[model samples]
Target: MSTDSFDPVLLEILGNKFASVTEEMCLTLQRTGRTLYVKETADFACALAGRDGRFFAYPRSIGVSGFVGLECLPAIEAAVAACGALEPGDVILTNDPYRSTGLATHLPDLHMIEPYFDGGEIVAYGWCFVHCSDVGGRVASSISPVNTEIFQEGLRIPPVKLMRRGEMSPEVKLFLDANSRTPEANMGDIRAMLASLATGRRRVAQMLSQHGAAELGAAQGALMDYAAGKAEAVLRTVPEGSYRFADYLDDDAASRLPVRLAVTVTIGGGKVHLDFTGSDPQVATAMNIPSCGRPHAWLTLRMLALVQTLDRSAPLNAGLLRPLSIYTPPGSLVNPEEPAATGVRHAAAIRVNDILNGAFGLALPSVLPAAASGTVIPIVMSEPLASGGRMVQVIEPLIGGTGARQGHDGVDGRDSGISNLANNPVETVEAELGVEVLRYGLRPDSGGAGQWRGGCGMELSFRILSPGSHVLGRGMERLLFRPWGQAGGQPGLPGSLVVNEGQPRERRLGKIDVLEVEAGDIVTFRTPGAGGWGNPLDREAEAVLVDVEAGFVTPDHAKAAYGVALIDGRIDAETTARLRAAQTGSEGTVFGPERDAWDSIFAPEAMDRLNAALLALPLSRRQARRREIFETVLADLPSAFPKSPANAAQAEAAQRRLETCLAETS
Candidate 1:
C-alpha cells in the first residue's frame, strides 16, 4: 500500500496515535526510572521506528528533545549480524559509538532496541535510552572530559541481546553488573527502559489491530512524507547561497589551546548541505563528537530546531532530516575516529548549534535569532557513602537563556537549544546528595545590550555538606569568548566559575576536571548570557527602566551598555539622552572584545589556510603541528593573550611569526 491510499485525515489521526504511543512510553520510563538522571533530569528518550529503522514517532514533552533524528538501523543490523535474527522477546543493548555507527554517541547513553512483531513478522521497533549514573570508567560518573580515548571513558557494550525469549539474559546481566559502580541503580533504570519498550509494543499492537498491518504501514509513510514536505517548504524559504560561520570550544579540556568548529551551509533547491571542511582536528580530550561521518543528531539539531520553529505543526520524526545532507571531515572534531573519546561530546555540540544558528541568521536575519548562551553544564557531585562507595547524582543540569530576536527579548535563565532537561529541585537534590542550595536565580546584566535585549544568564551557588566530595562539571564552556550578537547588537558576557565567593581562600577557575571540596566550601556557577538582536542605542528608554526595576539589568549597566541613565528609581531623561548621543553604533556581528582581540592576531583566512595545510598531514601529527604553531606565536605575548590585548607592535610581530610558521609547515 502506498501513502496515496491513505486519506489526509486518516494520516493525521495515525500520526497522533503514533506520537501518543511514544509519549506514553516516555512517561512510563520516567515513572519507573530509578536514577536521578532519569527521574528528575529526564535525560532519556523513547521512540517508535518503522521497519526501515528510522524513527516515525518520538516523545515531545518528556525526555531529551534533540535526539529525534537518531538512527537505529546500524545497531539493529549489528545485532542481527552477530547473534542471528531478532525474535519477538529479544532486546538489543549497545553503547559503542562506532560499533553501532553513532546510534549510542557515548558510553553512558545505553541504547536499547526491541522489535515489535505482528503475526510472526516484524512491523516496527521500540527504542529508548537512559544516561546511566555509572558505567565503570576513570571517574565516579564514568565521564571525564580529560579522558583521552574511548577505552578510558567507560565499558563498551556492543549490540547484543539483553533479554531473549521473554527471559533476561544472565550473561549480559553479569557483565553489566560487574562494570558499573552503581549496579543496582543501573539495573533499575534498565528495567524501566524494558517497561517502556513493552508499553510501545502494546500500543503498536493496538494500532495494528485497529487499522490492520497494511493500513498502519501506509499511514506511517504518509505521516513522514507530510513532515518532509513541511521541512522542504521551510528550507526553500532560505535564500539559495552558501553561508559560512565558525565557533570554538573554549579549550580542549586538557589544554589551553582552543578547538575550532567551522561549517559552510549551502542551501539550494529546497535542500541544505553542511560541509564541515575547516573544523579543527579531533582533540586528545573527550570533547570530540562521534558523528561517524553521518548527519548525526548532534550535527543536525539546529536544522530540526529551525523547521519546528517555523512550522510547529510538523511531526517530529526522521522525515524532518530528509532535506538535510552533511559532510564531516574524517578526523575532524565533528566526526572523530574510533578511538577518539566522546564522554563530553555535548560541549562541542553546543558550539555546533551556535555556528549553525550564526550561518542561518545570515541567510534569514529576521527569522533566526542571535547566538544563545551556548552552554549546558551537568554539575554532578559524588559524596562518599558509609558502605565504602560513592553516591553520585547530578546536582543540576544548569543552562542559560535563549537569544533575542527581531521584535522580542530573549527568555531569561533557560535555553532548550540542545537538551530540554528540567532542573532537579533543590529539595530533591539535597535529599539525594550532600549539598545545601544557597542562591539560585538569574544574574543581572549578564545579557547582551540591544534594542531587543538578550536573555539573562543563570547563577547557582551551593555549599558542600560532605568533605572529601568530588565535583565533576561536564559540558562547561563559553568562558573565553562571549556569545556573539547579530546586526548592531552587543555580545553577551562570558561565564565564570568561583569557589567560596567573597570569602577568604576564594579561587576563580576555568573548566574543571574533578574538583575536590571541603565541607564548608561554597561553589558558584554563573553561566553566560545570550546575544542581543539589534543596536542597544536604538532601544527605548522606558524598556531599559523596566529591566532596571526588574533587576534583569542593573542601573549602572543600563547607563553604560544601553546609554540609559537612572536616578533613584526613574530614568533620568537628560542624562540618558546625553549618554546616547556620545556613543557610535556598531554594525554587523559583534563577537565581544576577547574574540576581536584574538582575531586581530589570528585572522580567519590565515587560520583557514593553516587548517587546510594541517589536514594534509597524517592524523597522528596534525594536533602536534597545530599546537606548535599556536604556542610559538603565543610565546611572545602576555600569558593572558586574547583576554589582554597586545600592543600594535606586539600583535604585528605575532602575526608575522604566525605567517612564517605556516609557510615553513606548508
Candidate 2:
C-alpha cells in the first residue's frame, strides 16, 4: 500500500515475529509479577508500538485485549517535552488519565513506556500496563464507585521518568512508594514491568540486527496497513444503513437515578461511525469513562471485536480501528473532562458495549449474537488479621452466561465478551482470606428461555469465618435493566445480593459499596443471565425435558416458558401439543418487566431530547439540572426504583412529571 511495502510472504513472516515478541514480553511480565491480579487474573498487557505511538504488534491471547487501540504517543510526547529526548535506558511512567490523554484509563492502571534505541536513534517503542493492588487514596483498593473526583481515587502520576540510564529515579521512586498503601507490591509490579520492557528491547534489537533497521521500519508500517485493509473488508459486509440502540446501567452507584447509554452506528462504503451523543452526563461518582473526546481504546472495543469476528486471523493491532470513527460528547459519561473520578470506568464501558452491540445487530443481525450477561463483579474480601494488618483477596471473579445467537445456545456461567479474567480457585481464596466457600455454580433457570437458550448466570455464596470483614463487590451491573433478548426471545432474570438466607435477619441489597459482616455471616451474589434468541415455543420438547431433568429448568418453569409438558420424567406428547397451540406469540425485544416499567416513564426518544438539552447547558449546570428532574420524578415512587415497581397511580404521576420536564427542556 505504501512505498515501504515488502514482499507479501516476508510481510507475513515479520508480522508473526513482531506479535510473538509482544506475547513473550507479556509472559515475562506474568512470570515475574508478584500480585494476585497479575499472577491469577492477568490484568496486564505488553505491546510493540511504532514511532507515531500506535501499536503495530499486540498480544492476542494474554492480558486486557481491549487496549490494542490505545495511543502511546501523547504520553511519550508529554514525557519528552517535559524532560529531553531519546536515550538508552530512559523510560516514562504515568497513570493520570488526563495527562496521558486517556492512555492510562484510571489511576490504578499504571502505564510504562520505554524507547528502543538502535545506533544513535530510536527505532520503535515498548509499552506495558499493570493494575496494581493499591495506590493510597480514600479506599483500600484506590477504587470505589462513589468516589467523586480523581484526587479522591488515588495518586495521579504525570508522565515522568521512572528510569534514567538503567537507574531508578530516586525522586520518582520516593513519590510512588509514599503514595501507595502496598508499597512493596507496587514496587514489585513496577520492576516486573521494567523486566517486560527489557525483554522487548532485547527481542527488537535481534530483529534489527537480522533484518536491518530500514526493513524493520518498513515492516511496521506494512503490517499495520495489512490489518487496516483486512478490517475495511470486514466492515463492507454490513448492510449500508444507520442503526440506533440504547441501554442503561442500573444507576451511577451513588444515586438511585438510572443512567442511560445510547449509540447510533452508521455503516457504509467499508466504514462505520459510532455516535454517542445522547449518553448521560458525566456522573459525580467514579463511573465516568475517560475517553478524552477521542476514539480511545475503550470506545472502539466493539469495532475491534467485529473485525475479529469476521476474520480471526486479522492482525490484532491499532490498525483494526482505521475504518471506525467515534463521536463521544465532550462532557458525556463516555468522554468526561478532567477532575472526574474514573476508578470504576469499566462499569460504563460494559453498557457502552451493549448499546453498540444492539445498534450493529440492527444492520447485521445474523453476524452478531444477542446480549451477553454484561456484568463482571470481582467479589473481594477484606478481613482484619490477628496481627492487625488487613488481608484482601478476591473470592471469585463472578460472571454470567453469553447471549444466545441464531443457531447456538448461549454459554453458561462464563462471559469473556469484555474482559477475560480468570476466577480464583476455592482453595486459594480460602487460604488467603478468612472465608469458606459454601456453593459456586450456575443458577438454575437463570438463562432466558428460547428456541436456543441464552447462557445462565452464576451464583457465588460464601461464609466469613472472622469478624470485622468487609466485602466489596465493585463493577456490578445488570440488576435493573436485565440483559435483553431479541427477535421474540425472552429476557433473563435480574441479579441480586442476599445475606443470611432463611434467617430471621435476612437482607437483600443493591449495588453495595462495602458490607461489613460478623463471623459466620453468609453472603450470596447471583449475577444476571444473558438474553435468549428466537421463540420459546419453537424449542424442541426433548431439549426442554433434558433441561428440566438437569435442574437447569424446573418442571413448572419448563411448562410455562416452553409450553412443554413433562410427566413422570417423559414428555407428555398429547398435553404438549395442546399447550404449544395455546401459547401466545412473543412481542418486542424482551427486557423483562423491570426495564419495561422504567422505560414506560423515561422513554427513549424523550430521554434523547433531554440529554441533548442538558449537554447544551454549561458543564457546571448539567448534573444539577439533570438530577433535579430525576429526583422530582422519583419523589412520587418507592425508594427502590425499577426493583420495586410503582403502582398504577404512582406510575402515572411520575410519567406526567417527566413529560413536563422534557417538554420544558428543549
Cα-based TM-score, every candidate = 0.98, 0.96
- Model 1, runs deviating above 4 Å: 68-82
State each model's CA lDDT, in order. Answer: 0.89, 0.85
Which RMSD values do the candidates have, in order?
1.3, 2.0
Best by lDDT: 1
lDDT of 1 by residue, 119-178 (tens): 999898899999999999999899998999999987899888999988999999999999
Q: Name the lDDT of candidate 1.
A: 0.89
Model 2 regions lying over 4 Å from their true place = 1-4, 68-83, 549-551, 644-652
lDDT of 2 by residue, 333-363 (tens): 9989889999889888888888888888887
